[model samples]
Target: MASSAAPAPPAPAPPTPSASSTTLSSDGIPTLLTIPALGIKAPIVVTGTDPDGVPETPPFDRPDEVGWYGRTASPGSQGASVIWGHLDTPKQTAVFLYLRDLRPGAQIQVARDDDTEATFTVERVATYPDDSFPSDLVYNDPGYPALRLITCGGGFDRATHAYLSTVIVFARLTAIGSSANGSGTGPS
Candidate 1:
């Protein structure tokens, strides 16, 4: 007899870094990510993994907070930079609810702490069931510097009463600009 379980979704395509991409060093922590198309701008704090190997989740589990993985690629670096947030709350909108509406070629800008700015272009938007999330391919890919903006998707399962999918926006860095004085800072 055939099994009733659904097959796992295929892994996401490998990210391709643009020719103009740049690598960020230790000085580039605390980058700011802005999506003009979506009218979203927020500061990113560099953090490390907790004991359970999970990166910190802030502004998701708690509002009014910002955090990013310190061990991962900095905003301008040539690897995947993973950022996540919640979908909704009991009262307010969450950071990434609008992320699913982003189309290919949407503009995403990152301003480094040193005053440099890097711009990226969204390439795709995909949704995956939460049970079979492609974590390794999404977060561990080494081919190019990528950005994954993630949030909950799909309808809330009446049985579980929770969202069943994850919305992911894939983007690649395409432009970099430095401060006139070479300080690598930019206007907030």
Candidate 2:
């Protein structure tokens, strides 16, 4: 049965970070994520990977909670940090239901357990096919503090019972806030 059939094409390579990235070490656990432009304010919960090696999300019962991948660098750390949230459940909408509406230059604030806050500026928001998820792009170390916010997007396939794409928002750390120091500022 060796017919003249070409093998499937390889997946696309993940994008690399530019040379401007700088070093910024992690400090504390993130407790909340707030996006003023999206009117999003949710509690951040530490989550592990699922059997599929994807970051686990909060249960349907707690649609308002967002999940941070505990295995990766915490937000505002020296690498890309990942946070995931649900778009919607069969019954209700979740924390990131409108994530696709985010635009560049938007501010994303993450409050930490130590009463500190890390603020990030949106660089880009993109939607990608789930079949070829960009693991390297989302998890890569960018030589600076970066953040990735993921949520289900695109059309829902009834037969597959899943979303066809994922919405990822990429941002870099621009500031940090603390009660002791008043506020920690980073490069513009």
Best model number under lDDT: 2
Model 1 lDDT, residue 166, Cα: 78
Candidate models: Cα lDDT each: 0.63, 0.75
Cα displacement (angstroms), candidate 1, residue 164, comes to 1.6
Clashing residue pairs in candidate 2, if any? none
lDDT of 2: 0.75
| TM-score of candidate 2 relative to the true fold | 0.82
For all predicted structures, in order, the TM-scores are: 0.74, 0.82
> Tell me, what's the RMSD of every candidate?
7.5, 7.9
Tens-digit lDDT track of model 1 for 1-188 = 00111122233343344453265443466556678887787666665555655555554445433455555566666677776666665456666668799999997877777777767789999988877877775667555556777667877765655677878788886766763332332212
